[model samples]
Each structure stands twice: as C-alpha cells, then as structure tokens.
Target: MTTLTQLEWRTMADDHRYLIRDMALGDTTISETVLHPDQSTKGHAHPWPEVYLCNAGEGTLYLDHDGGHPLVAGARYVIPGGVHHRVSTVKGVTFTCVFEGPRR
Candidate 1:
C-alpha cells in the first residue's frame, strides 16, 4: 500500500495553475488537486467514474449545460462516465478525486 501526506505530494503545475498529486494503481487512479482562483480543467470526460471530495475553498463544478454546483469545503461529488465536466475555482479550490476502472 502507498500513502502520502498533503505536504508530501504537493506538486505544482507547469503553469502553476494547480498542484496535482497521484496515489493510484492499475486503472483506478486517485489524486489530490489544488487550483488557484479562476482555474478550470478545460472541460473533459473520461471513460471511468469519478468521485470527488472538496476539502477546501469554494467553486463550481460545471457539466455542460447542467450548470454547476457551489462546492463548499467538505462537500463530495460523483460523476459518471462520459459526462463532460470541469471545475471553476472561486477563491482557490482543493479536492481529492478517485477514478474507478479495471485493476492493474
């Protein structure tokens, strides 16, 4: 098993738009991500289900025409496969995401 502390895996993005840390195995992936204010994921979809936990800050999770949810600290969200979605950071956002897929 692998484990990481928040500070242990804190890694900055190329553009410094966010910080991403991975704790994944096989096809299932888990990650912790932090975004600065106004940061977004560029709206995309994966083939697997995604689970998210908002750890801090406020933001909106946008899904095409379905609008968004005002993500508060400690909130949780789940997204099914093939649903185009992206996150918009308000005053900066931090979340952990889990992706379910085949075992490695």
Candidate 2:
C-alpha cells in the first residue's frame, strides 16, 4: 500500500504505542509498524536478517547496545539477525520491515 491508511493496520501484540500489519507472499514477509510518540520497540532480535524502511517520522535505531543512527523518513537500513536492536521514536515513526520466510 502507498499510504498508511491503505494498509490494514492493527494493534501489535501487547506493546502499547505499537501498531502493525503483515503482508506475506511466498517466502517473504513484510510488516508495517507504527510507533507512537515517546515509545520504543524495545530491544529485541530475530533469528534471521532483515531490512527496514523508514516510512515516516524520525527515530533512532540502536544496534547491539552501541550508538545508533537517526532514522529519517525515506531511509532504509539492513540489520543482521541475532543482533540486539531497538527503535525509539520522538514524534512517532512508521517503518516497513522486510524479512525472509513467514511471519513468526
């Protein structure tokens, strides 16, 4: 979908301020997540490498407990799996993450 409203967004898990929707085809999965203001995705990791596109807003992407980079709109990032990572937003952020295999 080209717009946020065009996608079937839904509350993700029990994480407050987090919303997500999934689109899967074949062996790939793409998930769109919106993080509200003053919230974070919490430090977590997956078993497979993935990529993320900063769809909107601004945020910081920290990996492996080290310094992070600014996540500006229109930016893309590739994060290897098994590495600790987290996203913290200021005025909220919307990002689309792509990974191989089905959504777990």
Candidate 3:
C-alpha cells in the first residue's frame, strides 16, 4: 500500500521524453510514465510482459506487427513479452505500467 504522490518522479529518455516513478512490490514493478505533447518513446522489446493503463490525454501505441492503436484516457493495454512497442502522444498522456520483472 503506497501512495503515488509520495514517490519521486525521474526524467527519462532524450529531451525529457517522459517522467517516471517506479515502485517495487515483491516480484512486480509498477511505473508511472508521463508524456507531454509531441513526445515519444523509441520502439523496444522487453523480456517480461507489461500492462498499461492510460490515465489521461490521448496518444498512439505502436506495436510490432499490430501497427498503431488508439490510446485514449481510461484505456488499458496488455503487451506480451518480447513484443516491440512504443508510445507517442499528441496531447500529453499519463500511463501506469505494471510488470513482473526488473525495472530498467
């Protein structure tokens, strides 16, 4: 039981692409990522599965083979391990990403 507001957020990626707050809970790691307008993350793959919950704004989620998907506030997406994915936003977005793996 942890309060998100109590955690410290750190900047990540080139040009402050995103702000993240990470918390480790037993075997799982939960991260909050905030992306401002016109920001994007480079496509990459992870070794463990990841789940994303959109908390605000609209965006685009790029998945390998699946192309891009609409990412609106209140949406959720589950990505399999080793699947390449990236996120881009046009109007700023905040996402809660959960995974049962080590934090990068």
**Cα lDDT of model 3 by residue, 7-97, tens digit:** 5554443346877777766678788888889988777897888998999889999988476888888999999999999999988988888
Clashes of 2: 0
lDDT against true structure, model 2: 0.83
Which residue pairs in candidate 1 collide? Answer: none
In model 2, the runs with Cα more than 4 Å from the true position are 1-11
TM-score of candidate 3 against the unseen true structure:
0.83
For each of the candidates, give the backbone clash count. 0, 0, 0
The C-alpha local distance difference test score for the whole of candidate 3 amounts to 0.82
lDDT of 3 at 61: 90
lDDT, candidate 2, at 25: 52
How many backbone clashes can be found in candidate 1?
0
lDDT of 1 by residue, 6-82 (tens): 32343435455777776546566677788888778667887777888999998898875487887778889888888
Against the hidden reference, what TM-scores do the models get? 0.78, 0.83, 0.83
* lDDT over C-alpha atoms for residue 35 of model 2: 88
| Rank order (by TM-score, best first) | 2, 3, 1
